[model samples]
Target: MIDSDGFRPNVGIILANPQGEVLWARRIGQDAWQFPQGGINDRESPEEALFRELGEEVGLSINDVKIIACTRGWLRYRLPRRMVRQHSHPVCVGQKQKWFLLEMLCPDDRVCMDRTSSPEFDGWQWVSYWYPLGQVVSFKRDVYRKALRELAPRLLPMQEPASKHRKEQQVSRRRRQERPEC
Candidate 1:
């Protein structure tokens, strides 16, 4: 649902495999790739939306994945000017997402992107935890970085020094600038 601040209530999923890699899916017919995510319906809780999206987007049911953790609060990101739907009623300026980290309990063969008549993704892969930071759309780079960084410790140990972490973020930001928006 769209909130007073013009941000839509949404859920972002970060599905991680046993080896510390996160699921990254390519848009049905586009170069864009991202984690499984969807809006929270009018009466649905953040978690309900999460599970629904898990099945809709990735064909994974509740039994196929286990919830590991979620961001303590909403993490938001704004849409670029051209991407905003200005003509829609109660215009959405961006998304305020509750990000969840899920551990995959099913095998890779179980992922079916075309479970629905129309699929959100056509291909998928397992990528390093930090890969999406530099690869997601420009407007979403910051939010992705924040969500991944916050939820990562629960999935894997964070042994890097703070300085190294800062360095990695700086590098991810620079790389994000060089990538093209999809």
Candidate 2:
């Protein structure tokens, strides 16, 4: 919902695995990618909106994950002028999000991108926790970095003797090489 200040009240999701890899999703019919997020409804609380978004965007249920942490305040970002909606009642300028970090408790196969009739993501892959910090659209990078850094300590990456990030990258590269050109 768009707030009185012109910013939309939204919920952002960072779904990470035990290995500290985050789920990166591809927008349907587009090459761009980002974390799963949705606007919080006027009738719903941020937490309630979070669960609905988790299901609608990532095809996840509240029972499938454990909430590790959440932003105490809204983290905001502005939309580039060209992207702003001029005709809307309350000109929405950007989003103010309540970010959430969740760890998947179920097995990897539990992710169902097609769970919704109109899915938010058509493709998804697990990547390093820091991977998307620079990869998301420029406008949202700062907020993304803030969310990841704030939640990193809780995941305790320093405590792990090894990170599977390298392995995941290698597999991705190999698959890319094996695929035939269109």
Candidate 3:
């Protein structure tokens, strides 16, 4: 539900494979790709909303994933003025999210986009852990960066310094490829 701060209460899921690559999904008919996320119902807790959204958006249940870590408090970002709905109740200016890091326990075949009547994504793939922050919509980038940074350390033996270093290098290479050579 939208809160008084003009932010919607939401949950962000960072579902990772055994190698630490996170699940990235493409929105139906749109170029945008992001981790699965959804609003929290008025009656549901953040954790409950997370599990529900996970299943609805990616066909995963609690049994299919192992919770690795979650944000300590709400991580928020503001929407640009043009994107805000001035007439809406609670006036959601953006989202205040509780991010969760989960490791896939089931086979990749279990991940489906149409498990629910209204699917949030049309296709999905596993990408490096730091990939979403750079690829998500600009407004949400900061929050994604913060969430991943905070949760990365808790991801256990997989989050070794060498792995993190490799991920950083990969991100740098991608950024270079996206920019035109001077």
Candidate 4:
């Protein structure tokens, strides 16, 4: 479903727990982490693709999570130069995603990364909404921030301004401890 602008039709899933922490997963065979996202087939709507992607990537069924809200329209991001697949038809240089925010009603243990033969992710964790904005691949950082910002009002009221400060402090402290001193 590549559009005329060379963007693929896709769905991005932001599955959050009761505490407002979102699910982040490490891409298979890679350390890069991101929200679960997949292409939307011609036959399926964005919502349908979201459920299918949620199931495929996180072993979650529609019953396991409730859709809280979605971005009003598509949010897009370009692939980094090295990551683009120029040989593919339509020369898809990016993805225009309809981001879906889902509330996970099932227990965290129900998250199974290896549900399919070719899994999209290898591991997962729950992190604050803004965490991925700083940590996701550079090309995606802006889109991630935009999606989280737009859909954030629908999330639980835990993302107070002070919470952002606390998280930043936590990250700074962790980084300081992680670096070796001269």
Local distance difference test, each candidate: 0.87, 0.84, 0.84, 0.85
What residue pairs clash in candidate 2, if any at all?
Answer: none
Off by over 4 Å in 4: 158-182
Where does candidate 4 clash, by residue pair? Answer: none
Worst 10 residues of 2 by lDDT: 173-182
* Candidate 4 lDDT by residue in tens digits, 18-74: 888999999999989999999999989888898888888899998998777788888
- The number of the candidate with the highest TM-score is 1
Candidate 2, superposed: residue stretches over 4 Å from native: 157-182
TM-score of each: 0.86, 0.84, 0.84, 0.85
User: What tens-digit string does per-residue lDDT give for candidate 2 at 83-111?
Assistant: 99899888999999988888898898888
Error of 4 at 29 (Å): 1.6
- Please provide, for model 1 over 63-135, each residue's C-alpha lDDT reduced to its tens digit, 9 standing for 90 to 100: 9988877888999999999989999989999999999988899999999999999898999999999999989
lDDT of 3 by residue, 146-168 (tens): 99998786554444467467767
Better of 1 and 4 by TM-score: 1
The numbered model that scores best in lDDT is 1
Q: Give Cα distance to truth, residue 127, candidate 3, Å.
A: 0.5
Which segments of model 1 are wrong by more than 4 Å?
158-182
